[model samples]
Target: MTAPDRFSFNQATAKYWPIPELVAGCVEAGVGQLGLWREETNAYGLDKTAELVRDAGLAVTSLCRGGFFNTPDWYDENRRAIDEAAVLGAPVLVLVSGGLPEGSRDLDAARAHVGEAIGALVPHARAAGVRLAIEPLHPMFCSDRCVVASLGQALDLAAPYPADVVGVVVDTYHLWWDDQVWAQIARAGREDRIACFQVADWITPLPEGVLLGRGLPGEGCVELRRFRDAVEAAGYTGPIEVEVFHAGLWARPGTEILARTLAGYLAHVD
Candidate 1:
């Protein structure tokens, strides 16, 4: 069997799985790459998690988010996140530029704040050898989840920093709706700003909080292969991290979830 080199199973796909068990499962199943969330990583113990993954001979593709700039403690939190990524040997620290701060509808101010916040973290990120990857959430999440709602927006915010220190995440679920996403991906490539690439299918009838609505690749309407082609064409040669989030999927066993995620990736992405 020809294994997928860049097929990384994001830990969130099996949201409730114990980190140690997940690591063991990945090793057993021949999955060499993974993406992780801070909360889970922290719960598993930062150094412990790093040691576990290292011992398993797995590669930590990217840490799932270091940014929430709108928060009061963003400075310290982000620096801590950078250190965490470095500790885990993860090269990328995903950034979810937080949405409009409490009761502040001024989108312009909020976006500007995000840029400045990232600028402040650039030095730390560079020093730690971690790239801050800005992820553009869907527009529906712009008001409360992320202000960077499009690839173009993400690219714009990352423009002021060195491409090595700041870059963008290419997620199909979020960028599929944008007609100009192709152009933006190309621009990101031209500028060497593609830090990471994530895969998730877009599904409808989102949950109440609208957080757990993603589907496995080929389970939704997204053009998964097309997005993959765009990212590859745009010069992104890193791991294609599969990061689907959904309540139903979370209810299953981690092993089963990993199997299904791999099947979907082979059918729809690779």
Candidate 2:
């Protein structure tokens, strides 16, 4: 069977796009899914933002974030994020396992901390009908941002949880460099652990200390069609949310970036 259609855009890309205008632009572009951010949601207020999306008839694929597990006092913060996801009817909460504590040498310890934190919040997430989507950042981000740095690793961390409560996001920019990505995708499919499938191209020689250099779909070196096919073969039919974090792209007009992004996705996906 042909893969079912599922495409989404994260509003965070439109950081420069005014909320009302962005919603209208997304609707006009025929983009059906969105990933909302906590700061933006709070700024617009949940009710107003939801009404805007509702008026545009958009489906919220996932909330931008809900975890920063390295924090010593992150529990309450995470709980509040869970509540917000439920309020917005977002099915998944993208988690970026936080960085190492100051003067700490133990990466493994930080990862363990992530496990403990997620374990603590799983019950609350389930209660709120929010699936925790563990996003394995690229290994380049291992030191400062995410300890979980591979799709396989994220899957291993989430294996014990019930499928509906936990799963993994397969982002092309993050996992495309892995030699074993296809194998991991099959494993995720076998276990039904794929929660979100996102995309952005990988750019090299990344600037110093800057974590966000994501390229537009066709601008960088990624095997887009192969990645999409593997994820589809693994039984994930969720929206393909394009999450580019480029400063250049972000500075451009929202409508132009979005229009180009949609065209690029269609060009590369098939």
Candidate 3:
């Protein structure tokens, strides 16, 4: 089967696009899907942001994020995020399971915390008509950002939950280096756990302590075509969301970045 024809640009990459203008630009660019940020949605007012996206005929691919499972008050925060996602008509609420708590060296403990938190949020997310997309951050981010470091592990945590309420985000930048990624992707597809598929290239020697360093497609070492093929072969036919987090790219004009990103994706991805 042919891949879906929609591709989306994450607003986070266009850090400069004020809400309304970003919506307009997304529409103008023929982008059918969008990833909304809580801060931006709040800045524009949830209703207004949702209206803008709907008016522009854009589909809410997935919300920027929910879940910092390591925090003492993580449950409340994640529940609120689920509500916000519902307000925006976003079907999936991306979750970044937070880092270890202060004085905590047990990564396994942190992971258990994430699983419990997700288990609690499952019903709320289901009630809100939103699916929780567990984003397995790169191993590089294990210390300070997220404990979900592999698709396999994320799947393990999600196994007990209903598929309609919990799934996974296959961001190439994070999972590309994983030796078992292909198998996990296939499993996610088989289980219908592929909620979102994002693309970004991997760059090394990234700034210490920051897990946001990612490159535009074709600008780094990831085998985008192979990855795309694997995802597609697994029966996931969804928008390919471009989410580069490079400081330099963010500084450039949004249009330039969008154009380059689309071109790179087309040139380097299958």
Q: Which candidate leads in TM-score?
A: 1
Q: For residues 1-270, write the lDDT of model 2, one tens digit per residue.
A: 112248788887777787788888877777777888988888989889888888788889999787778776689999998898888889999998877877897998888888778888899999999999999998978877889999888988898789889988999989999999999999999999999988888877664545677777888899999999998899987788888887878889998988878877888874
lDDT tens per residue, model 1, 1-270: 234999998999999999999999998889999999899999889999999999999999999787889899999999999999999999999999888999899999999999999999999999999999999999989988899999999999999999999999999888899999999999999999999999999887666656888999998899999989998898888999999889899999999999999999999999
Report, for every candidate in turn, its global Cα lDDT versus the true structure: 0.92, 0.85, 0.85
Angstrom error at residue 11, model 3:
1.0
Ranking by lDDT: 1, 3, 2
Structural similarity to truth (TM-score) of each candidate = 0.98, 0.95, 0.95
What clash count goes with each model?
0, 0, 0
For model 1, state the Cα shift of residue 8 in Å: 0.4
The TM-score between candidate 1 and the true structure equals: 0.98
Q: In model 3, which residue pairs have backbone atoms overlapping below 3 Å?
A: none
- The 10-residue segment of model 1 with minimum total lDDT is 203-212
Looking at candidate 3, the ten consecutive residues that score lowest on lDDT are: 1-10
